[model samples]
Target: MSSLISIVLPVFAVIGLGWLAQRRGWLGDGGAGALNAFVFRIALPPLLFLAMARTPFEAFGQWRFLAAYLSGTAGVWVLVWWLAPRLGFNGFQARWLTCLGATFSNAIYLGIPLFETAFGALSAQPVILIALMMNLLLVGGSLIVLQAVSGEGTRAAIKETLSNPMLFAIGAGLLVSWFDIALGDGADRLLSLLAQAASPVALFALGVTLGVAGSGVRFGRPQWVLLVAKLFVHPALVALACWGFQADAINAQAAILIAAVPAGSLVHVVAARRGTLETESAALILLTTAVSVVTLTLLLEWLL
Candidate 1:
């Protein structure tokens, strides 16, 4: 509880400040997007690169952690697929949104800040691991589904995944580590500075985005279902998977924390681009984030 009030509260408070800033017109037009773009393209890449570069090859061999996270994600996807139609989310797009809502997590924005606070530099290990899986499998897979559903080639999706700067960073960092390349003092300092900026800035940008969007969604049965699934069911499944896999204490806690976060902002972005379930996706983003405060606090109280 003290951990929640001291560390976690301040983090969410930053997001609240971002939201308040947006509502008061302090962020202006397109500010959040620009900030997010900076984090995505510049700050985070170097941060991630340095983190991966510093991690030992042995740490990346945590197949149990991957298995646990993947099992939980797969479970959610199957559960949602089977239950969505009965719950009125008919058609492929709607059902996919529901499945996405349950499985996808705000791993980059809200996640990084929390992990940085709790786990410090070690936070990057699980982050790099999750990013590799989440970006390649879930996010890229979504693109493939979209292209396939729309009668296009899936090759483009694979290319897009390969071209992602963060993914590029992870790969580059791994190569450097493999060769034992020396980055020296200047480069190290530069990366540290950039990585330090990624967390707070990302959280602020997230809050502004929420404030700017998702203003008109009404909470209903589907919304409640998504809320419960994302905050509760997903976390529980991941925790169980971690225990079954005999993950180390640190990995188990990290996996559970990531699972307990809100739906990914990317979920809403994908929905808007595809012109389907925009309102519902927006609503899920807002509601899950708001509700995660309680869920995460309770989780931290136990996990920490």
Candidate 2:
């Protein structure tokens, strides 16, 4: 219990502080966007690059682990996509939002810190491994779905996906590792500085976003469906995959934990950018994040 509290409390506290700051007007209007921009465009990319560059390529070869995790996530995504219309999320944008909420874990902002605190620096390996797959498959896939549904050409969707900074960083890092490229001490130091800023800033920014944008989102049936899919169905599928694939104990635990993270705030970002389902996405982020406090704590106690 103490271990769980030590890991979970500080993370949510930072988020709560950001919420309080926003509610109290400490950062003024649009302050959260500034912080989120820094996180998305600057801090997060470097952090991802460092994570990928530092990990051995052999670690990426954990095929069973990757298969288990991806299958679980992809399954949930597909399930939501199929069920959305029946659930009254009948529009293309609405279905896209449902799919995003179902599969998009808050891997970078919340998962990284939570796993690192619970399991130590070595925990980054599994977390980043999952993050890479999530970014590639879920994020890129969602963009394609949104663009396709909005009647954008395939070229446009492809271009947008290729231009994603996070995806670019992941690719660059993989290339660096593949070629055994070494950044000299100075460059390494620079990346370290930028990477160090990602977690606290992201958590705080998420809180601010919740305060500013999540205020009017009333929980309803759709919110309940999203929460259940994200926090329960997703992780259960991952656990089932672990069992079927006989993944290594540590890897299986990491996969399940990653699956249990709340919906990513990026869902809301994408909705806002596309002028679709913004309020519903925000509600999912806020509610899942709040509920995750309890769900993640139980998970930590069980897995740790």
Best by lDDT: 2
Please, what are the lDDT tens digits per residue for candidate 2 over residues 1-304? 8878888999999999999999999998879889989998999888888888887777777778779998898789899999898778887787877898888999888998888778876557777778877876777777787777778855866777778788888888888888889999999999899988988898898789889878778888988887999999999999999899999888898899999999998788778878888888888899999999999999999998
- The alpha-carbon RMSD values of the candidates against the true structure, listed in the order shown, are 1.3, 1.9
Candidate 2 deviant stretches above 4 angstroms? none
Extract clashing residue pairs from model 1: none
Tens digit per residue, CA lDDT, model 1, 113-139:
887787786666785677568867777
Specify the poorest-scoring 10-residue window by lDDT in model 2.
153-162
Best by TM-score: 1
Between which residue pairs do clashes occur in model 2? none
* TM-score, every prediction: 0.96, 0.92
Superposed on all Cα atoms, model 2 deviates from the true structure by an RMSD in Å of 1.9
What value of lDDT does candidate 2 attain over all alpha carbons? Answer: 0.86
- Number of backbone clashes in candidate 2: 0
